[model samples]
Target: MLKAERHAYLLQQLSKQGRLSAIDEAERLGISEDTLRRDLRELDMAGALQRVHGGAIPRPPVPASYADRRGDDRTRKVSLARVAASLVRDGQVFFLDGGTTALCIAESLPVNLRATVITNAPPIAAALIDHPGIDVYLAGGAVAKRSAVTVGTEATDFLRRFRADLGFIGVCALAADAGLTIPFAEEASTKRVMIEQARRVVALAGSDKLDIAYPYVVAPTTAITDLVTDHTATEERLAPYRLRGITIHRQR
Candidate 1:
């Protein structure tokens, strides 16, 4: 097949499967693995897909800013948020990562349920203002304007002071192989600290974020104890995470 046709075929496969194995696709296309690797490389250079160790996954969508992403897939975020909120115990201490979904999770918590929430996002802290039973601690640092989250050494160091019962990580992209990834470097650092300080890590991702990858990786799939996503996620797509011993919670 021509190079253009081959690229189209690969892209089509990615749309259907959300992931592509190099050897399998090469065999299917009646080409050598080396040739397929070259095709994947070209596609990666063109920003079509992200190539992983032995396969490729879709590139994560990058909205203009956090403000823009607030309205994108709002319902799905709420659904995942509800599932995440259900995991909270009344007296547990939780680390809330920054993102629109994290805000939803904060809002979804029961009014009278008492808990301590440490977060890097001011918006999430503000959302919990009326929750009289909940204690909110906003991390201090340089806030990234794009994500509206505090990042840097100061934020990460602040998180080290207390151990949390659960960490609700709002990931930009999640894949079995690539794990959890986000676009910015300093935010990734802050998230890493959150994961480290928590006993259990729960990732809140939308269906669109599944099987996709981004530039900066926060943690491997094994790092997360639970994954909460919308009902739109297929069982086939979630099988990998389940096999990794992550409890899956799908929105009803």
Candidate 2:
């Protein structure tokens, strides 16, 4: 293929899959890896894609921000959120982790429900601000600019002081072997503290996030008591968690 044709092909594939690893793209296109890297660089410079460690992801249609991220996979997130919200009980203290999924759960919370929600997510805190029966405690710490979540030793320390009845953790990725993994180191530490301080940990995951693993391991597979996912998650994919005695809830 001509150079222009190859680049166009790469852009098409990225549009379909949302991302492509350099090695994988090279093999698929029958091009040298160096050539593929050059193509990726050209595309990156053109503002067509964002290059990551070993892959390129599609550039957002507009300038990307945290708000943009929260809008993706809205349907699946809403389903997962509804299932997660159903697990909450009145008069309980709950820990809400910071992520798009957790934000969805906060939005889906019943207005009349009574509970104390502790979180580091400004978005979640804002969503609960007007609830008369629900009290929200925003954890104080250094804010993570990318995720808008408070993190570091201070946040983790505050979490350890209270034992929450339940925790809703949002994960970037999950594998049967790798458990829950996220991209950031400080976020992993904060999530670990939430898991430890809660009596029960409920993970809110979308189907697309399953079977994927990231660099930082937040918690082991055994740490989670339940996982709520969208209806698209198959029984075969959920078998491993079931075998490990974790309840799997699918929302249609």
Candidate 3:
């Protein structure tokens, strides 16, 4: 392919997969690492991609803050939240992870549902505070300023005492190979503990998160019992998870 065509394809790959290592891109494109670096440099110069330590990610028009993320797909999240909330029985225990998607599920919880909620997110706790039937347990630890969630060794230790019926997780990326992952190492560690302590793992993710990989690995994809995502996700894209014995729920 021509350089321009190759560059365009690279951007498409990055958008679909979130990030790509230079060596992998080079191998995929049948080019040398130097050539891939040059391509990444050009894309970076044009503000088409962000060059991270050893990979490139697609550039957003404007930088997204943690608060900004909650508003990006309000309609989709609400629909997914409703489906997620419906999955909760009246008296089950749930662990809500620290992510905007989980926050939506926490807000959409039924007023009379009597589930016990264990969460590290301040927003999730605050959202459920007024619900008379639901009991909220806020895990204590170091607070993550960006997401307003408590996470650390202390929090993980606290969670070990109790097991939840369901663990709702969020992620920066997911791959069949890499599983669920977030950007920060500490957060990933806490999340791993959450997965281990819960009987079933349910991931609330958007289509954008599929097939993506981050620097840190939280759990393997096989760990998830169910995945809830926007309706735009293709059946082909979700087929692998089904093959892995994961139930996939798509929210319109």
lDDT, candidates in the order shown: 0.91, 0.83, 0.82
TM-score of each: 0.95, 0.75, 0.80
Using lDDT as the yardstick, the better of models 1 and 3 is: 1
- Model 2 clash count equals 0
The candidate maximizing TM-score is 1
lDDT of 1 by residue, 1-252 (tens): 999999999999999888999999999999999999999999999999989999899987765698998897888788888889999999999999989999999999998899999999999999999899999999999999999899999998898888999999988889999889877777888899999999999998878889988788899999999999888788988999999999999999
Q: Which candidate tops lDDT?
A: 1
Which run of 10 residues does model 2 get worst, by summed lDDT?
57-66
Ranking according to TM-score, highest score first: 1, 3, 2
lDDT of 2 at 6: 92
Cα lDDT tens digits for candidate 3, 55-118? 6765433325578887888888889889888889999998999888888899898888899999
Model 2, range 15-119, lDDT digits (tens) per residue? 666467799989988989999999999998998776665777644332135676888878778878888999999999999998888988898889889999999
Record all residue pairs in model 3 with backbone atoms less than 3 Å apart, i.e. clashing: none
